[model samples]
Target: MMQTALQVLDREYLEARCSLVELGAAFDRVDRASDHEENAGEFNDSRLELLKQALGILTEESHLPNRAERLLLLFSDLD
Candidate 1:
């Protein structure tokens, strides 16, 4: 049986909200730690750029599927 939108939200909202909170906290920590550093160039790391791109994908309003796969592909290029 398919769950209604509200049902899905009820079941999943807390977990999703927590995940977002955790991600935000991690970014906050990074920013705070970077502020103490002497030479933290603006997004000097490729992983940070990838993380920003992944956040962009998450924030998109056009309902696209396979977001995890898309993010995986985005991160797969380690070179």
Candidate 2:
């Protein structure tokens, strides 16, 4: 269910959201082994996958669609 949503992001957006992209990169490094990191939960593939889902919602918004909910989703969980 979650992984499929991440893949859906590849279809909806061109450029990645800046903060989300950076957060993802940071998380990826931690995933690769770094331990001292912020947003540690983001490092898990499952969580990272969810962030992708959230980012897609933000970036694919048409002419800045309402993002208040999506922004909260970013700080919260995808499920």
Candidate 3:
């Protein structure tokens, strides 16, 4: 079956979003690691900042309100 341009774009966006979520989870894990507590403080903060920037860019490009909320809820869940 041939996919339309929009279908292809949507699939790509979904894949990218999933990848970003996975990346965030990995960072969250590191942030919670007691063994790396001291260094993780700086590292986790930088990763979180970068992830937020990436999420902001994705939301802007897609003009998706739900995506922004999803990102917000994601970080909120970690808290």
Model number with the top lDDT:
1
lDDT (Cα) of model 1: 0.84
Output the TM-score of candidate 1.
0.80
TM-score of candidate 3 to 2 decimals: 0.41
1-79 per-residue lDDT for model 2 (tens digits): 4668668788655554665578878766766663556665444567666766776776674665568666686777457
For each candidate, what is the lDDT?
0.84, 0.65, 0.69
Model 3 lDDT per residue over 9-35, tens place: 887998878988897787678767845
Per-model TM against the reference: 0.80, 0.39, 0.41
User: Candidate 2: TM-score?
Assistant: 0.39
Error of 3 at 73 (Å): 27
Query: Candidate 2: worst 10 consecutive residues by lDDT?
Result: 34-43
Error of 3 at 51 (Å): 2.8
Candidate order by lDDT, decreasing, is 1, 3, 2
